[model samples]
Target: MNTIEFLLSRRSVSVKLITEPGPDDEALDRILRIATRVPDHGKLTPWRIQVLRKDGQARLGDFLAGRFTARHPDANEKQVAFERDRPQRAPLLLVVTAKVRKQHKIPELEQILSGGAVCHNILLAALAEGWAANWITEWPAYDDEVVRLLGHDPETDRILGFLYLGTAAEAPDERPRPELSDVVSRWPQTA
Candidate 1:
């Protein structure tokens, strides 16, 4: 597909529906390289990614499960298992973090937005690499403990997204989008 066609057709496959045969080592490296090719204000490179392979996924799952149980003592085994299996839902997971530099001249908001751009770029790269991709910032993103366990200082870092990459078990349907008229506005040119 051409660039415009690809951009228009790109859709995030559901993480729950993502299956196996994800990007290989070379493909992953290429994806990572492409994912970082985003606008970084002040050239701060404020984003970081943690590739969670099998063992890392397992460890994260265990931590999430324990956290879930602590938060909901009455949660059933199925619920606990759901929390435990979130990371393993996709064949490969990436934790995109906004590592903001408070002392830098760049605004903190800009740094965070740069990290968000990285998350989007990661999804685009994975999709271009023939992998179904989804960017999610579920409960774990807001949990300080989870962030700390991921080896990041929650004070200076925040989880931007959790990118899930894998083969799609089923094609995703296009969802409804906002009308351009409703979303777009013209700012009158100043004299």
Candidate 2:
């Protein structure tokens, strides 16, 4: 599809069951480069990418399971297993982190927003490449233990968006979006 058509038609496949994403090193590099082109006020480029392959996914799942077990000694086996299997939901995952620099003239919130834009770009780029992608940030993503395990700087506030990449077993349905009239408003008067 063309660029405009791609943007308008892009939809995230939540129930991803693809056999493989097959994003080779070159293709992945291109995707990452595109993702890095997001808006940055001070050009701080406050974002980091953590690629999690299949094995890494297992490790993450194990870590989460261990964490859950430690937090609740009395938790059931099913709960523990569920935590361990969570990461296996996706074939590959990319952890997008906001590496905020506090002393910068730019506000911390803007840095976080830039990180969010990076996540969106990752999703869009994957979509444009004929891959299924979804950006997810759940409780595990916000867990301090998980962040620490991921080696993010302790002093900096961060946004953790897990971008799942894979083939789509089924085509995604386009959801309703806000109309222009509902979202946009012209300025009432000029200065």
Candidate 3:
């Protein structure tokens, strides 16, 4: 599909069976490069991508569970279960971190906007490649322990979102979007 068609047709695919999601190195690199071509003001690429594949995914889950357990020694069994199983939702999880650098010319907010644009581009690229992609971050996103375990300096790097990528076993249902007239506004005054 062309650029405009791809943008309009792209939709998030959830409930992916994901039997195999190991994109080849060449394809993966192309996707990463496309994902990074977002609007970056001041040329500050204030973001980083972490790919948790195979053994790494399991290790990350263990690290998070351990930290969660340590943080709340009095936590119930359900909380522990949630923490442990959170990482298994997807076969491959890509963590996007917004590394806000202290630059005199650019504000932290703009850096954050750039990181958000990166996440959107990733989803778009995945869709264009006929792969299923979903961006998500639940309780772990806000947890200090999780951030520390993920090797992010919370004071500088913020968790933009975790991208879950794979192939879908079932087609997803598309929902209706708001009409342009409902959202768009004209600049000049009309009678």
Query: Whose TM-score is greatest here?
Result: 1
lDDT by residue for model 3 (145-166), tens: 6777889887777888888887
Off by over 4 Å in 2: 15-19, 72-74, 189-191
Clashing pairs in 1: none
lDDT of 3 at 179: 96
lDDT of 2 by residue, 96-121 (tens): 98899887789989999999999999
After superposition on all C-alphas, the RMSD of every candidate to the true structure, in Å, is 1.7, 2.5, 2.2
Q: How do all the candidates rank in terms of lDDT, highest first?
A: 1, 2, 3
Flag regions of model 3 displaced more than 4 Å. 15-19, 67-79
Candidate 1 wrong stretches, greater than 4 Å: 189-191
Q: Please give the clash total of every predicted structure, in order.
A: 0, 0, 0
**N/CA/C clash count, model 2:** 0
In angstroms, give how far residue 134 of model 2 lies from its true place: 0.2
Error at 99, model 3, angstroms = 0.7
What is the Cα-based lDDT of residue 63 in candidate 2?
Answer: 99
Candidate 2 local distance difference test against the native: 0.84
The total of clashing pairs for model 1 equals: 0
The lDDT of each candidate is 0.92, 0.84, 0.80
What range of 10 consecutive residues in model 3 has the weakest lDDT sum?
15-24
Q: For residue 84, what is the lDDT in candidate 1?
A: 93
